[model samples]
Target: MNRTDRLLAIVLELQGKKTIRAEELAARFETSVRTIYRDMQALSEANVPIIGAPGQGYSLMEGYFLPPLSFTASEAVTLLAGAEFVQKKLEPNYGVHAESSKAKIEAVLPEQVRLEAEQVRATMRFFSAREAEGSRRERENMELLRQAMLDKRKIRFHYAKTTGPVLQRESTRVVAPYGLAHIQGAWMLVAACDLRRDIRHFRLSRMSGLEETSDSYELPPDFNLEAYRPRDDRELKVILLADPDIADRVRESDIYYIDAFEEHPDGLQIKLRVRRMEDILYWVLSWGADVTVLEPESLRSRVVKEAQKLLERY
Candidate 1:
């Protein structure tokens, strides 16, 4: 970048961090220490409040602030896109905040850039939240869970398990929440269940009568989420042959189960490793006649049996 842009970026960087060494800035900007020193001198000459000390680092003087900067057309569009995502994917409260934030940003941006960003936002859409069907109570629960996680406090809620098409008996649960994850279009809370003395994943939709408790607990430092995640020990390699017409679409998806794909004269040969045979079976069935199970006799037989049952019903 040019020297003028580098000088401005250095000021922004200092504003972000408490202190930055000349060496660190040099590496970050891909320049020599001498160039950094010169840049720092230039900033100070321009009346930018920068303090420097030996054996320490460079820092912005206390109470020093930069003037509001203009956003480029690209930057404005990027920010608007992120706001649009938060509005569509997150809960109602967050969606409100996202809209408010977008308005504030637009108010400060150049009119031309803001107008361009609006056009970009109009072109995108999200149907995930609609499919998930979040209610007001669920949205409130999500916010409460987030607050509890941040405060390191306990939460109490009545949870019900889905038994077939109906819910079974409801049970009161008190737990210390660790994190929240969106999996397969559902919101799940990962927490340490006090009753079970183990970590469990609770669907937020299944929880009701939520309340935050005064009890606090420290999370174990050694607890790595990767280690705590559920893993399938048994690896089953399965293969499929798909018609060339929809092969590219399947390949573009990059499903987690798929390992590789090879082109055949009539179709695409796909290889996958899955923990459960049913997983691959359902996925292959989704393609209908476009895909055929090529290996693992058990999977092929299961598919044939299911297809025959469907035919019999028809």
Candidate 2:
């Protein structure tokens, strides 16, 4: 951006990495070494504890760590604490780096701050600590799928659906593999399920024997996962207000996450990207009065009719 912004970015770069050469920083920011040297001086004058051999660039002083954006006391507690929490969520092989980095963080925190962090550490609860499925296979299928998706090569896989038996499938549709996401502590794969005639999301653990075919295809120019997704609001636009306390209940439900409620002043308003009125009605009815359905007269009618049925049974 501007010269002032560039100088600060240089300091942040050094703080983030163990060490960086002046020439490397200069090249990255498109500035001369002389300019970088001047920026280093400006940093030092501002009490930014940057120190290293001139040729080696710089390193944050082990004794002096800078909190991101000069954090206030509680803010500092939140940051280091958040990092510690993430240490548990990550798969271990990658978490070694996180662990070593956490060690440095704890080393630099004042004793009181570190103690406060520990108090938090003792109280957090994880529902399921079992090692997740596809803890290993996911990494393998991902790489193969990534190549096939990008080069637009066809893929063959033995995939098992949520409700039925395993099946073999292949198609000429372009495959676009997006990143892996963790949901309910399980890994899910978001990719175009070629035979499904649209973008599809699959649990990685459900896919087996993924094989890339030798043909390459072009992705139709207008394909988007968001647009292709199924909605659960019928043909009507159904918005909903969910109870704040009922959030966990919603998450625990078997409803697919085509779109979901986000908390707002109107409460947690969930949008159903795909229609499933029978399903959504059952979902709302399960919550009782804790959730209020809004919009779409059709959905309201279904809920009302279901409530009548339930009352009759009672």
The residue pairs found clashing in candidate 1 are none
Candidate 1: misplaced stretches above 4 Å? Answer: 126-141, 155-175, 181-215, 222-234, 252-254
Runs of candidate 2 with Cα error greater than 4 angstroms are: 1-10, 13-88, 123-126, 129-156, 163-176, 183-186, 196-198, 210-273, 277-314
lDDT of 2 by residue, 236-272 (tens): 4567778878766765664563366577875677777
Cand. 1 Cα-lDDT: 0.84
| Top candidate (lDDT) | 1
User: Relative to the unseen true structure, what is the C-alpha lDDT of residue 142 in candidate 2, on a scale of 0 to 100?
Assistant: 63
Task: Give the root-mean-square deviation of each candidate in angstroms.
Answer: 4.1, 9.7
What TM-score against the true fold does each predicted structure earn? 0.78, 0.45
